[model samples]
Target chain A: MIDPLSIFLLLLSASTPILFAALGELIVERAGVLNLGVEGMMITGALAGFAVAYVSGSPFLGFAAAATGGAAVSLLFAVLTQFLLANQVASGLALTLFGLGLAALFGKPFEGVKAPPMIPGPFRINWIVWLGLVMVPLIWWFLNRSRGGLILRGVGENHDAAHALGYNVRLVRIGAIAFGGAMAGIGGAFISIATVLQWTEGMTAGAGWIALAIVVFSNWTATGVLVGAWLFGGVTVLQLRLQAAGVKVPVQLLSMAPYLATIIVLVLISARQKFSRRAGGAAPGSLGQNFHALR
Target chain B: MIQLVPRSEVSTLWQFLTPVLAVLATMVAGGLLFWVMGYDPVAAIKTIFWDPLFGMASSYSRPQLLVKAAPLILIASGLAIGFRAGIWNIGAEGQYIIGAICGAAVALAAYPSEGMWIFPAMVVAGAAGGWAWGMIPATLRNWFGASEILVSLMLVYVAQRVAAWMAFGPMKNPEGFGFPGSRNLQQYPSASNPELIAGTGTHWGVVAAAVAVLATWFLMSRHIRGFHIRTAGLAPRAARFAGVKPETLVAFCLGLSGALAGMAGLFEVAGPAGQITDKIGVGYGFTAIIVAFLGRLHPVGILLAGLLLALTYIGGELAQLMLNLPAATVQVFQGMMLFFLLGFDLLTRFKIQRRVVA
Candidate 1:
């Protein structure tokens, strides 16, 4: 009695946010910068987008505000990790905490307020959904076929080599991080504006973290990111379907499916990478390491 | 042009001074934040930093400090060990929840039994539950080469869901007219963790926190395992050459931190909270991370940082009551403190120099 088309559509909607965030993280990682503040940026975007859309009566303006908000918060991470030479992990964590707090403070008024109506695009899906679908190929083209993408990969593979070649490492990473932030913000806005249609505290939940896992699951590849997001989205939609079908399992247990699935995927990917050793798509050589220019 | 130059050795003086500087910086930033939010910055700062310890309500708030600080210190002390060795167990919040559930289940099962063995059994169950939960990430990281940070954080959400399920279903208080919570553990004398003194909020948890600090200090400074942990964090290759098994260290740090976090949760449920509820997670686990960093991952430093953060919690609440400041203000303050700390931490290992432009 299960409808495949409806489930597929739901899966697409559920996966779009993760797709956007993961793609952004993929670019950042490709540039050898691991900005773990995607969650923070996403939440900030969610609130900013919701608030702006609610006040302005335009979802486009909301999405714009979300991207700006996400980028602005990410710039804080750039300042800390890129400029100040702080630990990437710690700085990213702090960014998340700061973003969460800031969003909560800003979102107090937006609580229970309905989000503005979304403009239906092709197939009656929101434009952002279509935009997300388009971005996969676009990002793939950018990372694989573009000159900027080559430089980003070169930097990630070996910052020293890139720096030796007179490339500005920090500038490239800052740009990637900002783009990642903007994408994460848009992803977060998708949740508030297109999906949930209302603002709430901590609404992004673990979607950002899931996106982080998806990047690793994707082995830093754009196509792999799409697959991973779909897999996770499938799990999310399936779990909801199971609940709707009056399964014997508790709803709480069903809710844990996506997170548990992410962990399982991560473990499998890591184990495979460990055993394969000379696998083509290994993590970036200089990922999570701060680059410093010696005088 | 100003530039940062890496030093051969970290300055001992800056190591201690950066935390103080960060605290001061947070105050200024937080004051400005309050000002922007349409409140008197001076009054808000005073309420947040001063009122909890020395204001008119000092007598009441003094004890509350220990109550607030006990879990933070306990959890942070454990977290500091793992952080020292670079084994990030960010899922202590999950461990804390499981520990509380396990401990509460023990007490709930022994409801009418007036025996000394019940509390001890609960404590053991709490620690064991946390250890078991911690092992998931440890084992995954060890065997599968997974990232503990993501795995542990993922578990937190899982634990939260499990806690919610318990509150709404199996653990719901049967005698409370369909309410979603376990029996009030505080009223159950045989299972309660009561304040040892009349006015002070001293309890078994506070004693345990103090003991943990001493124990961690001794381990980090005097023990070989602790030496291995520090060496592994500082020089992984050297530690491996010296026969320090990375797997063992990862397991030990995660397990120890998990146990401590669990004990903190158990103590909280038995003493202050008095019952297992869906909202049992008040973010002490996350806050403890900030405490661990603020204390420079040192036991003694963590103790002081715990007290300072606890002061903020109490003061934040006071501000909320008096000035109607949003509850999220304290979270922002804490986050700002960590941000400033990480930023200022640069001075410990590097010196900023103004370069001559030719």
Candidate 2:
């Protein structure tokens, strides 16, 4: 029988990566930029973090490297979308492809290698798990109560109007993209360094996509994202428990639970927004639109 | 500082020139990557681009190009239409898998039976299965306002699991010591999609891909529906005023593309792959997206782009054998090509001018 507290602990650990990624995406979307390369950046971070930690014998340094690596990859996207005025959707897809290939090329050496063991925090959870928990409230405050957030929301709602008010729309978006990349990096590192304790190709295995789903499920709210992440995490942990207990269900069918749950949650949220006669959906006005400051 | 000025009219010359420009830029960037990785850049490049066409092994590799490009062209032909109509159906991979499973189910059910109707029946089942899978996101988006991108992508994971389930459980071969794959269709004459002309790599899939190209060209250029699709993409309000229904366009585009992608899967399984397995999808669906963009969403362009991408696959393999390059090198080249393609697209839509500081 699965113990209640142990299962709860597993849920928290399982949820941390998506929590960090969704939080980062939240800020980026709030700033009116849709960066769909979270998976790419996360994988880059996974390899970099794992390699750095292996060489230096410190998981903290590995996490730092991951953040840096993720941001570096995001910069390619920023240049393409912001500076070159490329289509955001295509550019984001290109970034994912590029990052996955780049990581695989570099990660060849790291294959079959164990990541440096992570140190547990006060509650015997990994330190990064605690960090993800703390970041939820912190991000909530930043998005809901901060001046910078107001500016970001303004830019997202109406870039032309924000530009008229003398805000630097491109600058704010660049900053948000970078922050999103860094957060995604940490999340990816959490997978390699804390959870899996090993480096493997495609190890993130669509967690980044799941994170993207969680963002929508949260209705672009930081607190809502927390709930979405936990919901997903709980499903994952329970699925693993069922597998370990030798449940009669096919493993492949059992593996589909989290993805199916994401689709269901997304439909439920979207249905409510559609049928409830809510004033307006919480999506930022200028989401996915390219902005060029034309006078 | 440089400033971009929007062109009053898109430059026809730039439209034709940018793809070539992007290719050159990718070569340079890829050369740099190869150099940094401690390989002889020139040799690596030559092995990938030149050897596949003119080298001693060209006879063997040249025919292989058609085999590789058939599915990409078929899938991209469908996708390009939808993309032009402003509907994103990124779940073609899932649709493809479902189609293959459905098509293979027909054959599996008629195992050891002889009938000319088997292959045709499988094709219909494949397209229907794909169309059904594609409709999920279209229906959800129409009724519930869900983002089709996320929903379609989510289904890919679901489809993968379903494929795995079939491989291990219901669809496993009854013979051959309980192996987790179905009976090979290549061994079954009625169910097989063999190369029509030996040494030419011509098969039913290749023929289907050619038909798709011509059919989409006619549809997009000579049909009223195509006009509505273009109008909707350019201006939704104007399209509405012109009597275009967004829901119909969404459903039509998604359904059509999903059907094409499904046919590609059916062709692949019945031809090259020969059986249903957990790992049937080797990312043809995703790669087709790149092909659609690289071809500039044009039918003729897609043909050339599909061939070019097929060349890269062949070349990448040659390089892997001769130069000891990583298997992922081809993936990197494709990604870089797309990056350069998008980056260079700025030139096609705008005129860059040097800013004079006042």
Q: Candidate 1 residues B1-358, lDDT tens each?
A: 7878899999999999999999999999999999998999999999989998899888999999999999999999999999888899989999999999999999999997889999998999999988888989999999988999999999999999989999888988999898889899999999999999889999989998999999999999999999999999999999999999999999999999999999988999999999999999899999999999999999999999999999999999999999999999989999999999999999998988998777
Model 2, A1-295: lDDT tens digits are 6689999999998999999988999999989888888889899889999999999999999999999999999999999999899988889888888888889888998898888777688978888888898999998888889999899999998999999999999999999999999999999999999989999888888888889888888889999999999999999998999999899999999999999999899989888878776623688899888899866
Model 2 Cα lDDT, one tens digit per residue, B164-272: 9999899998895988988899999999999899999998999999999999999999999998998888789999999899999999998999999999999999999
Give per-residue CA lDDT, model 1, range A1-295, as digits (tens).
7689888899999999999999999999999998889899999999999999999999999999999999999999999998889999989999999999999987898998899888799898879989999999999999999998999999999999999998999999999999999999999999999999999999999899999999999999999999999999999999998999899999989999999999999999988987785653479999999999884
Task: Report the Cα lDDT for candidate 2.
Answer: 0.91
- CA displacement after TM-score superposition, residue A269 of candidate 2 (Å): 0.5
- CA RMSD of each candidate after superposition: 1.1, 1.2
Tell me the TM-score of each prediction against the true structure. 0.99, 0.98
Q: Per-model C-alpha lDDT, please?
A: 0.93, 0.91
Pairs that collide, model 2: none
DockQ of each: 0.88, 0.81
- Give candidate 1 regions above 4 Å deviation: A279-281
- Quote the lDDT for A141 in model 1: 96
